[model samples]
Target: MRGLSRGPPAARPPRPPGRNGPAYTPQRMADVSAPEPPKPPPTLPDAEIAALREAGRAWEKAPGRSSAGPEVAPGLDVAETRGRPGEHYVRIVRSQTQGFEPVAPGWLEATPRAIAPDTDFGRIRRRLRTALLGSPLSIHRVLHERLDKVRALPVLSSDALSSVAYATEQIVLILAVAGTAAISADLLPIMGVIALLIIIVCLSYRQTIKAYPQGGGSYIVAKDNLGPVAGLIAGSALMTDYILTVAVSVASGYDQIQSVFPAAVHYRVAACITVVVLIAVANLRGLRQAGNIFAAPTYLFIGAIILTVTVNLFRLITGSIHPTGTSIHIPMTESFTDLGGMVLVLLFLKAFSSGCSALTGIEAISDGILAFKVPEWRNARTTLTIMGTLCVVMFCGITIGTEVL
Candidate 1:
């Protein structure tokens, strides 16, 4: 045993006891330990907090993270920011204050600044002004120059007056279809009703114009008075009406032209397209310039109708008038009784109502009240009166002419 024994076998130093006894130490106990918790971030200074709030506000107003802030004023820095916490920082730099700048002071309150004298900017500016405010010599100008135009108005008034021509045609067509006899009896009453409706519409639109001087028209009124949905409906209806006006006016004009030049009878679409192009060109030229060009024709058209009606009225009262070619043997449609009496009357009424199309432009003046010059309300009012009178006269003349013929 002494010869074969290992040194380690002699050194059995310790053995762990069972429960409650001392335990043996492990050699690798210190290798893997639990980590400690992290520390909190540093607090921001008062100046940094204020700067952050201001930056946030600026970003909200006009979103960007640049250094620019409010305009430089006395003891104020437009460009300055507090540095991060626990870091070096720079305060807002100070500057001198500059007072308010006038957009336009004397000539017109905020008159648009004139463009460069040598550049096309002048022409563009002039065109823009003309489109928005109208020329000094045109009906549009007169409307813009006075507030009364909002109530009574001119260019749109003339448009209303022009409606009489088309309105009478609609009535005559309705009556002729109903039978020549029906026309002779109902014509005057129908005219009276239509006239009454026109007046009502005019009055309604006048109130609308006064209430909303902005150009939203029916859309604005509906939105303000009714709600957004109603405004949308009004807007859609107006757009539809404008489209119909273009189509109907051109088609009717084409028919008139065809009567004189039978060769053009088949070219109705072409004529309509031409008229649309012309209108677009006019619009592109700017409202004021176009108004200047159209003023003479508009007035002449009124004058012509007035002169013709006055002469015709005198002749009719004196028993010397002769009917025109179309009026002499006016053809009546025979499809009325076939459609049933009640249905036909309803149809005629509907047509008569449609003829009230003349009243469509009545609100345009009011919508554009802001377009007028100084003393806006007064200018608008005067223009409105002129428009109303002209419209009344023109409507009456056209109605009577249709009746007499």
Candidate 2:
């Protein structure tokens, strides 16, 4: 291998004086080039512009005519028609870009007419509903629709207050099974216990209102404090109570009706359903409306109860009314005293449970605190207190009235 020393490599070409690769001219480009002045929007040629004007004038003269005019621009349907008196309107029905076309000099722009709902029945239904329930209120109107305490007391307290009507009857029915002796012996004590319970429950819920102003009742409180499961259980229990309350109220109401109009007993089921539906419809109309619907009767009933109780008390004080001498003959085998302590205790418990129905709607105020006017929690608390006091008075009065009258 002959070493042909190709002469030492020619000296490497020097990089131009800066760093390695290319020499830096260091010419600074402008960081942001000035934005090109916006191009003037394209305009129609004078011929086309003049034709459009002429066509607009022609359309104004014969506004009723429809035509496929001479093609000026592709997909431009030019028609001459009256729109607003002085201004030109153009409606581009079709375009390649599928974009809004500029209003031409003299054409009318037609707006599509509104399509109605599919069924006449729908309109009929809506009209009928409005006639029945009144027009629906908007969200902004919710505050206006809120209840004051006067209205709220009847609306929310109806269930509780109405319970007083039947509560005494229920207690008496249970006691009557054990005879008048058991009734005379047991009614006062049971009434006292129920009255105390009402106070405790009412006070508890007032605190609940204070604590949870947003107003979820037991469900919200339980969920936040205990857990979701507990809240669900509480909610379920409330729902069950509501259902039973409705059922019991309707049945009891119909019973009274039947007593008044004996023929109504033949239509008991129909009558009960009608009452339930009426109540549900009233409530659906909005709480304020329901309050109005119920207010008169509720107050009347309250007045009657109060008057009856007052008169009874007065008569008793004056010694004008003596205790009802109605007596139930008990068998020697089942004498009142022979009824064991266990039997008496159970009977009292049953009577107490029946009377506790008076307390059923107590939580309604707490649950619906948001429905109250401003200072919802405070109004709610005050309403709860008032409701409780009224209930206590009414319950005790009714119980005593039952005994003496």
Candidate 3:
């Protein structure tokens, strides 16, 4: 067997060297390289440049999104991408995007969107109607169900009742200033006028309760029958009246309580306001709860006055009664006069008007008619009747008692 030779092949000879490295210069190649740097990112065409400007303006005015992405603008529906990573490129949407279309030049003004109509009336009406008259029971059943709650009704009813106390105090104060001699016989007729006004206001409010069982009271009545301005006036007046009711009622209550406990007299205004806030909170718990809380005091007050009046009337009739503190003999002032002049008449009218403050709370029932359980209007009317009867008895007894004793 012959062994083959294992040997390296011969290396080629080195050619002549150029400046840096050995290289053979072959036949010269034709010059093939082109001359410009990649043309400055194909300049956006004129039409496209105009489109980009318009799109930029549209984007400025349009709704915004939080992140970077193509977005529709108000005038330009289609958005174009402007660049790629590390190189500038204009990215435009293909012609097929839905709702995308070209806008004519100068067509950039945006129309304001139309406002939507409110649909809250149906909901409000449903709520109010449910509150006012939706229950199925009869008036008697409703009243019976709420009988326990009748106590707090006095907090509402007692405003007028308590005015008796205020009237007496005011009259005494007036007499103190003008002198006992200035206290005239005309006070009798003035008292009568005041009584009549109370009755009138009470009855008028009863009608209001029956008509507008919704809670706005005078405001509701005036608005439904008259107009918004009238309603506004009524609302303002009612608000003022409620505030005065608290001031006057609590003030009078403070005076009565203070007569017995002198220490509380100095804080009368704050005490009155406190009672008003308490009453508002109790009423907020529900109408029934307030009625229940107030009813007993009201009845007790009425009964106490009635018994006192009856006993006094009996004493007067039997000729055994004398006025309290009468032996002190208040001295008459120089202002005292018997002349039946216009000034005297005006004074009488003013006094009567002031006394008529008793009628302020007559509107409460009207304001709270919807709070009745069922047959709301009828129950409200019944409540009104009870209130009226009690008012008449209280007013007459107080006036008569004042005159006699």
* lDDT of each candidate versus the true structure: 0.65, 0.82, 0.65
Question: Which runs of model 2 end up more than 4 angstroms from their true locations?
Answer: 1-119, 325-339
Q: What ranges in model 3 sit over 4 Å off? A: 1-152, 175-178, 181-184, 213-216, 266-270, 325-340
Best by TM-score: 2
Which prediction has more favorable lDDT, 1 or 2? 2
Query: How many residue pairs of model 1 clash at the backbone?
Result: 18
Model 3, 329-378: lDDT tens per residue?
Answer: 46644454543455555665566667666666777776766666576767
What's each prediction's TM-score?
A: 0.61, 0.70, 0.58
Error of 3 at 133 (Å): 26
lDDT of 2 by residue, 1-405 (tens): 487656777888855665664454434224335657999875999899889999999887896666767646543554555588888876544532243334565443332112223588977887798888877665567678899999999999888988888898899888887776777888999899999999999988988998889895888989999999999999999999889998998899888888889987789888888889999899999988998999998888888988988888899889998765875554323654686777778888999898889889888999999999999999999999988998998989989987776
Give residue 399's lDDT in candidate 3 (0 to 100).
65
Clashes of each: 18, 2, 15
Candidate 1, which ten residues in sequence have the lowest lDDT sum?
Answer: 107-116
